[model samples]
Target: MLQDTFNLMPLWAFVAACGVTLVAGFVKGAIGFAMPLVMISGLSIFLDPLVAVAGIVLPIVMSNLLQVMRFSWAEARAALREFWRYIAVICVMILIAAQFVTMIPTQTFYLVLGVPVVILSLIQLVGVRFHISPAWRRPSEWIVGLISGTIGGLTGTWGPPTVLYLIALDTPKAKQMLVQGVVYGLGSVTLFLGHLQSGVLNGVTAPWSAALLIPAFLGMRLGFWMSDRMNPVLFRRATLVVLVVAGVNLVRRGLMG
Candidate 1:
């Protein structure tokens, strides 16, 4: 039963968590990023920190899988071929950094998740653009991948940094979506397996993570519908504003804890 897994969580809290995951999935479907940032930040407010991390893993993996399948297999493969270096580095780092998840203190965990979300969301919201020259693209990809993977391993969120890198390259919208899907989809699988070994995604937490997929999937489908009709730019800006607020609250929690 649900009670056996989330022994301390009440029905109301689980309902709220489903709502949060739904919203997070909607944002991700609309913009192609930020699901984990939204989920981890929102769920942390009510769940144990490790439980929150565990909770996002399956939804993230499944959601990104759906994102990838939206495009043709050929497109996904091309994105993977182009970004192999970055993806490889991220997987390696995620596996390594994940080993420390159970070792970090709770307050440190909050800061690890919060500070980067706040900083990266602010950077994008302010319209700061980073340019990566053709010559430097390869190195930049590896570097960004390393950093993104480390943070992702520790906190279950890494969208901002990866998105920043994509923006830096000035990737076209269509290509960017495929690339994000490829990168995030693979990275999320790594996160799932890494957490499994770290004991964060053990039997009890895994069910809770799996159960969230329903709400996450539904919200994503709705977002896909809205994305076809609305202005993504405006919606993305609004989401970033919310992320800043969420990130700030996370930082406050870390500091005050």
Candidate 2:
């Protein structure tokens, strides 16, 4: 049955993935987060994790590049300087973790991702309040960077930890979004190179990546349009719920596997 299902995947699967990409992109564009989470979770339902990751890489890179480009060079440079150590650690860890991708079992992947989603969701849902001390922010930045990079390399979903850490910093929304875009843009480039080195960038994944751009662009446009109208509190709450559900589903899938 599994083999039959795999063999039977048709154009509709691609279409569905594209649709999800649109939604994910819109969310990212509008709010500056959730694209990776939304896209990877949604896409993983229809395709293998590796294919989903590959499909997302180009669109995310493009989207983030456009976002970061909107910022002035001075601002971008300042932000990069502030976070350079963190970024450096993340890049190095991502490269190292990428080497071990082939060693991760599918079930293990699901569990590793699933457990975190649940915990993060519950924290948000319950309104857990914890702040990183100013004195510790520098070191914490490095820690978050390492975590994000490692997870990103392994699962192709790397935004949550960085997002959480940035949120803790109390940065203005615009700055937060810009910094995320720039950081992710850098990470995406590194990730793409890593995948290429691992030989995961093949014709099959390449076409899928191209096809995904349409929906991704659509989503980004929608998200941009909706950004101002949406309430931040509501959006965060909804995202947490989605995370919880996705986490549970992934855990279940892992257990079954």
Q: Per-residue lDDT for 1-257 in model 2, tens only?
A: 34433443477887788788888898787778778778877887878777776778788877777678878989889889888888887877877887777677888878877787677668768887668889998889778888888888887667777777876887778888888887888887888788777756555566667667778877887877787889977887887788788888888888997
Candidate 1 backbone clash number: 0
Candidate 1, residues 50-83: lDDT per residue as tens digits? 9899999999998999999999998998899989
- Cα lDDT of candidate 2 equals 0.78
Stretches of candidate 1 above 4 Å error? Answer: 1-3
Model 1 lowest lDDT segment of ten = 1-10
Best by lDDT: 1
